[model samples]
Target: MASLKERITRLQSSALFRGMTRESLEPLAKILNEESHKAGTVLMDMNAPGDKVYIIEKGRVRVSRVTSYGEETTLQELTAGDIVGELAPLDGHMRSAKVTVTEDAVMFAVSGEEFEQLLKSNHDVSYNLLRELGDRLRRANDNIISRLEEQRVNIEGRMLRLHKLTEASKSINSTLDLDKLLTRILEAATSSLDADRGTVYLVDDIKKELWSKVLQGSNMAEIRLPIGKGIAGVVAETGETINIPDVYQDKRFNRDFDKKTGYRTRSMLCMPMKNKDGKIIGVFQLLNRTDGAFTKDDEEFIDALSAHASVAVENARVAQEMVQNERLSAIGRMASTIIHDIKNPMSTLRVYAQVMKRKSGNEEAGKLADEMIHQVDRFVNMTQEILDFTKGVSSLNIVDLEFGEIMNSVLDFIQQDLEKHNVKLLRETQFKGMVKMDQDKMVRVFYNIASNARDAMPNGGSLTVRTNEAKGYVNIEFVDSGTGMPDEVKKRIFEPFMTYGKKHGTGLGMAIVKKVVDDHKGRIEIDSEMGKGTTIRILLPAA
Candidate 1:
């Protein structure tokens, strides 16, 4: 919008035209190209051929170069009266750096031929342009040096972290203690990546959850979450690594733990650990990296570490299995010898109890003998259970029996135990029907349940025993008012060698109980809650 006279005055103000009078500037200003640019516009790209020189009459533009890592380092900023792309045209080479508009600006441009002729004719204009180019060259050199030094430091830091990971991998494979192994894996991760806190969750397929146990001070905490429920859980389920620069920005992130613990979480990285077969076995979660958010480099480092950790975990498991197998071998031999030695005495007692029952018929003595015979048989069966368990063998003699007959014997036998533990037994045995089952094995099922309930209620509680018939099935349910199981134990309650809160517990009671029910074509269902109680219901086919 400027008039011809105004444009002449503006040209007169430029240092490049400092020595020119209005007569000399007027003809030049009329031919010079005028251009305008918005902020962030790239006026000159690095190494691109330049055909004209630009003089900024307004606004500012940054000159920068991209580093090897794709980071841009600013070399200089030019505002009004500064010239750019002049050196490249004068020297007959490509532009050395990129020029970007930092703000909206109008510029005056001169073709390379006109610029050269003007510089040649005017000494002051040439001298001023030389001074500005010298200053830019010096600053550009300094910026390049600084950027190179930064890249060197970054490379060295990465090398150090990789070295730490390599050494940790060596120690990890040799560690056989699973708790110690878990500790080592997490320690290496947090320290190597500069993370604030972390956890390693092993997947429990039977429970369909990602679970971990941590010892905080003197207490051990067991945490469990469903697969695909949270970030880490989803990583485990999908076998992918999830890196969130800002946890608060991610809707999938749960901030409740941070709120409760008063920990400010800024970032998170979760990786899935897989076994040799490519099956995901565990998940690793790292929270709040000390260096700010986790980066792509961090993810790469963690991915390598997770692979090493997976092998270490699997190796520890294999080593444990070897030890356990050896232990069971020893237990099996001792049990076999003991069972052989006790068989003769057990048979003799059985014969005597039967004879006493037959001889004392029609008297009170006969009833006591009958009870004694049943007690002897039960003791024999109990001993056989241990031997059979060690040998991994089981046999059942199925028969038709009534619920009333079973409950009557169970109540009579468990009454002494219930009184000893101060656990009162409430019965609802109104329903009666024939259930197809093994008499001895069925008795073992009820006995194991009573024993487990007694152990659960150390201080004194009530155990309710009820029986019913529905849909051609007889149900025997035992509900105990005792301390319930945690999720970890409740999930695998039927698995062998799983026990809780017992000093001399064999951990085989529930395993045997479930086996007995399974063998008789019946099923056992259990429901337990912490600080409340447990309910165990057994269903058997009715005759």
Candidate 2:
């Protein structure tokens, strides 16, 4: 046992006595009773009385609470020079958490009444205790902030991963080329999971093997493995995700490939890609992860991404086949139509040339020459329309032109055709402001509409062309008093390969008009009845 003087020295060294004067600590130290507790001893129980405060002199103590399941969860650990039971003494409440001696410990215990009296009598002792309590509160606040920061970081990481996966899916789905699609999928998978390299192996069901379609890190030729041969093969065969932290330790991992490629294998993540029918299409194999081994979260993310990849692969395969078949069909139809249409004009031109050669300087020779010129013009127009339809609207020569001027130019170009068809023309204008548009394309739009109107009226009818400005848009309307169209014909009028009643019609006129309007960010509305007439309205943004 130590002397009272030694006990006084120990008390003065404690955190609660940090700022106390020598005179203030001497009397408190003499009244404190020295206590000893062996390891595993319970110092206090929860909801117990608040009678004394204990300051640890040596050894460790654990503060814990019993959960509803009867399991003890440690809140904190205290060592020498720390104090417990101080909160109970200050508030006169039962112990909030139980304290136990984790190691054989000696402590100085002081009664609550005697401790309060000492604090009241000594101003230095009171200030020291208050300061110690404030320090504990700051430490508690710091712990809470640390925990919140960790949670925030975890949530942000999860959000970023989800965003990357979504973007990868979109990119993979956009391409129809199998090789390009596979490359993009592998790149996205390895990068999202922080893997060094990756490979996409598609299963060859007919051959009972798996073949690599895309390998990220190596320039080696395509590698083929039998089903159930390697890690990837096993996943493809069983349709399970395998995350191996050490590739060498796993019996499923094949070492021959590593030896041939001169690349040391460390870790691997292999998963099977399944289509909507639940049939495995391919296997995604990721090499060693950059940060560490792949986790459960990585497995879940890869599984979701693989589902999208499987659908994309199947779609690309089907789309490629469809495109090839369409190309062949289009080529056959275009060749046959061109040969049949041009043969008549060619025959007519050849006959007119022979007649001109024989009847030189005759009155009928001039008339025959004019007719020949007309036939050539018709043939050129037919060919030009076909070329325009195939080229598509890729670039536009945009300019600001007055709406009234554009309408006048279009009407003048088609006035002769209207007269030839005996169709009366009616023009109406409300505004003459300039509109930002592609001039040539806009002219083609009006030309196609006017030509369609001429074909509709074989006998004679009225053709109304009007322009107005309203709601910040320039509206152009072409209403014709000719044989109109039915509801079904009007509905599909703007679709390619749809024509109601016309000979030598490629069925691309209205489709081209709609494409031009859409490219200019404009709208087109058509209203037609079987006998009443047709009204085609175009709205373009006013400049």
Candidate 3:
């Protein structure tokens, strides 16, 4: 057995008894009892009332919590010279975590009441305890802040990647040219992903091979590989996105291309481009990320990029087909016009020739000759009109002419056509002033509008033409009580070859009117509703 003085020395050496003087420790030495726990012994149960404080003097002990799933999670391991159960005595509460003996252990145990009395009697002991508790609280707060900062960084990275993907979609969708569209797609992929090099391989279904159109860093001849030969080909065949940290280690990676080009390949990411119908169309591959190996995030980003590129490729192909169709249509319309215009003249010529042959001996033969001459004149005039229209309005005989008189002449020229369609015309002019213009071109503008109105009101409708002179400008408006245009047609009304609801229409009338207006430095405005009426307003600078 140890002597009283020896026991007192051991007590003062403990962490809990630190800073206590010999006089203060004398009472604790007598009250503290030496206790031993066998290995695998439970010293205290969590949530149980604890009235004693234990200071470990030998061996190791584990502190742990039992989870809701009934599994033990070790909170900490404490060895000799450490203190446990001290917090419970200070707050007079139950144990927070269960304490178990991992090995045979010895501890100094003191009742809660005795420890409280000792703290009150010694100011140094109380001060030391407060300092230790403060340190533990600070460490816990630092751990919490570290976890929150990590979460915030992850969120910011996701948002930045999403923004880049959205911008890439917009850039590729803006163009219909195949060359420019493919170039932009490759540029966007390499830059956004921080790739050192990239290439886009489109699958040629007819040839049953993969062909590259755009490859970064070198202008090589088109690369063609069989459908199952290389890594990119595999991705195209399988419709899978692959990320390889070490391209050399993969057996499927082809090294012959690298040797031929004198380029070293490192990391690789290959993704399949699929159309909206979910059919694989191409493969996009990137090599050697600038920072490190490509991760799961890079795979997700590239997958989204490939989706947009697929749609853009399809759109460009469709637009090209439409352009080809328009060219063929223009050729057909030109041939038809030439044949239609010359047919009536040819018919009149045949009729007069037959009459002249049969009436050769008649008294009225001279009168018939005069009629044939008149018909020849009409044929020449028809050919000249067609030639003028095809030549466009190049020579503008610009001169000062009364605005009201020009309007009257345009109305009279289209009067017979208006009567044939049963359309009424109303004219209102507030200006009789002379305006600088090419009379022939201005008359053509009025003729086109009147013809359009007449066609719109097949049964019958009123047409109104109004002119007004304002400060330094003149305004002419054509309003018609005819079937109006839909929003889609109205938006593209001035584009050449855009027409609706007319069988014999060439769709060039408004386009020509716009050209004339622009040459004179003027503006045109249109207002219409589907079921309501249509209005066209033109503004010209005053002479």
Per-residue lDDT of model 1, residues 355-437, tens digit only: 88788666787888778878777877787777787667989888777778778878887977899889999988877778788
Greater-lDDT candidate between 2 and 3: 2
The residue-by-residue lDDT of candidate 3 on 1-543, one tens digit each, is 456687777777766667677776776777878899999999988998888888787889988889899989776677776677777877877899999999999888888888788789887777776775575467557755775797699889889888898899999999999778877888888988899988888888977798765444564345677887688889988998889998999988889979998998999999999998899998889999998888898888888888899999999989987884574355445645765777787668857766785778665875566556554654553334334444442456677788887777667657767887889888887777878787767667777888887878878998888899877778998899999986556756876667878888656668767877777778888998866789998887777
For model 3 the local lDDT of residue 25 reads: 73
Better of 1 and 3 by TM-score: 1
TM-score of every prediction relative to native: 0.74, 0.43, 0.42
Encode model 2's per-residue lDDT on 1-543: one tens digit a residue. Answer: 768779878877888787566766777777888999999999989999979989999999998889899988776788888888877877888889999999999999989888777777877767877887787778768866886897799899889988999999989998999878888999999999999998998887888888765443563245678888778888988998899999999886779878998998798999999999999989999999988799998998888998889989999979977774475357446745775688787767767776785678776876667557654655554454455456442566678888887778668768877998899888887769999898767777888899898888888898999999979999999999889996657866986667877977767779878988988999999999888889999999898
lDDT of 2 at 225: 81
Q: Can you rank all candidates by lDDT, best first?
A: 1, 2, 3
How many residue pairs clash in each candidate at the backbone level?
A: 0, 0, 0
Which prediction has the highest TM-score against the true structure? 1
lDDT of 3 at 66: 92
Question: Using alpha carbons, what is the TM-score of model 1?
Answer: 0.74
Task: Please tell me which model should have the higher lDDT, number 1 or number 2.
Answer: 1
Error of 2 at 498 (Å): 34
lDDT at position 188, candidate 2: 92
